[model samples]
Target: MNVPTEHLLILSAILFAIGMGGFLLRRNMIVVLMSIELMLNAANLAFLAGARQHSAQAGHWVAEGPVMVTFVIAVAAVEAAVGLALVIAFYRRKQTVSLDRLSPTGATSKAN
Candidate 1:
């Protein structure tokens, strides 16, 4: 079954907005990473919708959308891996995942 391009685009927008909100409003590093993933997924949906619309115009489904999304998925996987590693390291050093508590250099400054 074919779905309308507008509907798909609207859904993508909503997903992106929700992800953005989560990314901005959440303090936990893991939740922020998940929010980033959500945003990426939203982008993938938009790409698929565009490809589907183009395919509909040409009277045939195209492979470009899925191909591009596959690459994106790979990149997102790598991103998630790296992000999780960083979060784990931060937790190990600080014992907390709160962004406000985690310093940039993981060092504590002492005033003399």
Candidate 2:
């Protein structure tokens, strides 16, 4: 059974919007990181949808989309690792994950 490509794209768009909203509105470092991940997953959905649509039209799927998605997932994993490490280090120094509480140097500062 095949699903409609437009539906997948719509879902992807929705996920990306929600992720952007969370990233912009949330103050916690971890939540921001999670929003970034959600955006990445939305991109993956778009890639898969494109691949499926291509397969439907051409009678065979190209490996490009899935291969690119694999690379994206790898990059996302690395991003999450580095982001979490920074968040942990910041929390260790400032005792808070709130972005508003952090200074440019990752230290605590008076909120303006």
- TM-scores of the candidates in the order shown: 0.91, 0.92
lDDT of 2 by residue, 6-101 (tens): 999999999999999999999989999999999999999999999989978999878889999999999999999999999998878778888887
Off by over 4 Å in 1: 109-112
User: Model 2 clash pairs?
Assistant: none
Error of 2 at 50 (Å): 0.5
In model 2, how large is the Cα lDDT of residue 94? 77
Task: In angstroms, give how far residue 45 of model 1 lies from its true place.
Answer: 0.5
lDDT of 2: 0.92
Give the Å shift of residue 52 in candidate 2.
0.8
